[model samples]
Target: MIEEGIVAFSGWMTNFELLSSGWRAGLIVFGLVFGTATVAFMVSRVIAAMERKFIETRNIWDDAILHAIRLPLVFFIWLQGVYWAAEVAYYYSEADVFTANDALLEIGFIWVVSWAVLGLIKQIEQVLVSPVKMKKPMDYTTVNAISKLSRMVVIITVILIALQTLGYSISGVLAFGGVGGIAIGFAAKDLLANFFGGFIIHLDRPFKVGDWIRSPDRNIEGTVEQIGWRMCTIRTFDKRPLYVPNATFTTIAVENPSRMSHRRISETIGVRYEDIDRVSGIVSDIRSMLQNHDEIEARQTLIVNFLAFNHSTLDIMVYTFTKTSEWVKYHEVKQDVLLKISDIIIGHGAELAFPTQTLHVADSVKLKHLEHDFGRDQGRGDTANEAGERSLRDNHEEAVSQQKSVEKHYAKPR
Candidate 1:
């Protein structure tokens, strides 16, 4: 009876000891989690307050920095607080404590890198909006190229840091990465080429976002929409978007029409050949109209004798330039010039030419008709010569009338 009672007491004591130890361990873990969370919360609030104070100060440089480096940076600070608190409690931590730290460091490094990347992007944005005027406006292609490159650089940096934190030997990893990178670069040669091409475009600045450009290689004309690492997108006047390789842009001759201060206008004007005597008067009138006109800014006039003869028309080219680059205004100027020229041409008492062909039959047919009318003429033999002459004159007049009627029917409209 004594032996059995001692065994029962010992078993009860062992069970109680286990229960107490488990409760204490659970409490310690709970305290560590709670303490880390509390520290993180406090750090976040401090960062937010500092950011708010900085914003309220209204310093331009400080505002840019605070605005650029706020949210992500504050989160990074919170992460650091949690990491530090975890370190402080590591003495009482479980067997997986070091592994947990590694994970936390990985996450923290990524956040830190992300924050830095965002700051860089914000800096670029500020530069674009800077009051310092550029020779050309900032283009979407340039902005995109810069942004994409910055992101790529940040990604590489983050990945390197992550590898380092994950127990990778930095030197060995880099050496292996160099070889692997070479292979990947070869595989993605076109992509890398385009990325570099986009970089060159941003630096060179062939065209801006709203500027119209035409490619010499391909007759494609459009305005730039976006510049990407591999390609650039252009929105055509017809509202179609064109995706072109960045490398091709560098190679092609791009004509930016919007960059010009004015558009060049050249047209040919046709006047009747009979108006040769009044050509000078017409030219002077046209010149005066162009010089005084509100739309056209005439540079100089050239007497371009395009066609010496067009059977009925004379071709003269009216070479000129407009001051405005607007398409609608250009059309208005052209229409005005044409109308004035047409009025002047008609007022000169000269009609434009029409094609006419004179047909002649053999003299035998006339002789045959004359023979048939021999009897009638013989009866009036005394006045035969006079009567024949009058009849022939009337017939010639009628033939001339018929030819004019045919010519007028086939004439082209002015």
Candidate 2:
């Protein structure tokens, strides 16, 4: 009995020793996890602080980079901690299978890596799309399309890689997807057409994002807001959104007003007929003003001429082009020129014409001959009326017969 009791006590002591060692290992792993997590937290804070400082003084690329990487960095920190903790626990506990814990860490690693790669892609896109970053900047539409396509490719590749790592048969999956894609292609012909149209638009460089385009063939005119894969979103002047199919751009004529070299100002100036003698001077002064004005284009046509005589007044024409292509600036320049022309005309003692008519009368003797002769008509009595009625009846019957003859000759048979 004494020997049996010693044997039992020895087994209990061994189990207690194993428990103590595992507790020590767990404490060490806890310290490691906490220390690493604290470091990661401090690093993230530092990055955030730097981003804020950059925003206050420098360009935004630094801020964008930090923003994109922060999540992935934090995720990787936790994954590393978990991995080290599992390794410590396995060594202390004498367990042979770390399958479950390793699997979780591995999956987390994949997610972190994928996220980091995607973040880098996003940073690249943001930098490239920034208007101030590049000297020869690409338009927003093209950059946006390329970004989306790249992201899709990256995501698909990452997903497939992860699946393969997890013992998935990628060949069967790809074959199925290929067959399904063919079926879907047939089902969505119009959608594919629009997709290709969008691709062509990006390649051919038509109207870009933010451009004001007008369709002469259709009722579409607006500022481009988003160029999507299937369609483009246009915000009209009245502040309504219009979704136009990409295929429509390929079929119709689009006028991009944003690309115009200049804005035109054409007007007709009518003057009082009495001021017709001053018209030539007014035109000469206007032409001089246009030629000397800073906003008027030097190469474009400038016309200030006496156009023609109207029913009530003489007309002058003013036609010119502004140097600025922007609408607001063009209007400002136009108003200044118009105001100057008005001042010049008023200073010359000439008035802008309104519609008017004039009538003249002859002497009273000639006016009397033109008066109605009612007394002569009163002398021609009922005899004249009866003769007129008989002649009118004969003419009416003859006209009716001629009309029926013409209708019978030309009308279609039933």
Candidate 3:
């Protein structure tokens, strides 16, 4: 019974000694877990308080940082706390029976994964929100493209980090990537051409939205409405949308009428042959009149010429240009110029000629016709001849009689 009691007591003493020896290590593990949890809770509370303050103040940017950016930041903060706890665990383990280098490697893998994931989240939030704050009107395509580009960069960076962590040398990987990129460049030559074309458009600014453009090669005339990476979108005057490849626009001649300060208008005015002699004087008057015309550059008005002599009349063409492109304003200016021209024509004594021809009858035919008339009634013809001569005398007598009657009617005044 005494030996059995000694054995039990020895066993209890051994167990107690072991428990006491491990108490500090156990306390460190407990503290690490407790500290990590405490820090995580405190971080979340602080973030919540910040969001509430931002909302109350009505600060949009601050609100974005709180609501939009806080989640990733919270994750990183927790990761940091975990990282510190992990370091404490490593220190405690170093003093124990086991080295935690293997555990540290495991933790490191987790850390990298956490960093990549959280970083991705932060980047995506920034990409989406950055354009929201911009004052310029947002283009969805541009925003999406920029977002995709940034994501791709982030993905590539994460891939490289993962590869490095897995013990791959970056120098060798870079060399392989260089060779691969060269092959890709050769394969996507046309895509590269379009990409360069897009860059050229941004730099050159050939045309902007709402501009009327004419492409020489395609015989396309339209208003520019959108410019994209692969194509330019144009809305035709007929209201059809045309998507033209950037390559074509970059290589072709583009006529942008919107770039001009004013448009030139040219036309001709005609007059008759009877007005030809007076044409030189008319031309000088027109030149003087055009000098005062608001729209006309008299230097460019080619001529007021006697263009041709046609079958009936002479053609005088008036060639001139207007200073404005607007169709309505141009017509108004032209109408005023024409009114002055018509007034100038009427001021001259020579009238505008119509198509006319002079008919000549032979004297022999006239004499024959009169002789026949005389023979048809000889006695009557003699009397008609005396009557024809007496008709002039009768007109003179009638005029004298009318004059005497007019004088008698006015005699009362005398």
Best by lDDT: 2
Q: How many residue pairs clash in each candidate?
A: 0, 0, 0
Under the 3 Å rule for N, CA and C atoms, how many clashes does model 1 have?
Answer: 0
Model 3 regions more than 4 Å off: 1-176, 298-303, 310-313, 317-321, 326-328, 335-414
Question: Which stretch of 10 consecutive residues in model 3 shows the poorest summed lDDT?
Answer: 1-10
TM-score of each: 0.67, 0.71, 0.46
Model 1 clash pairs are: none
Better of 2 and 3 by TM-score: 2
How well is each residue in 293-382 modelled by candidate 1, as lDDT tens digits?
676665545333454566556655666777778778778877877787677667766554555556585788666655545556677673
Candidate 1 minimal-lDDT segment of 10 residues: 1-10
The lDDT for every candidate, in the order shown, is 0.68, 0.79, 0.64
Arrange candidates by lDDT, descending. Answer: 2, 1, 3
TM-score for predicted model 1 compared with the true structure = 0.67
Ten-residue stretch with the least lDDT total in model 2? 369-378
Q: Write the per-residue lDDT of candidate 3 for residues 7-51, one digit (tens) a residue.
A: 464467567775442454455456656876787678778889887
RMSD of each predicted structure: 9.1, 12.4, 16.7
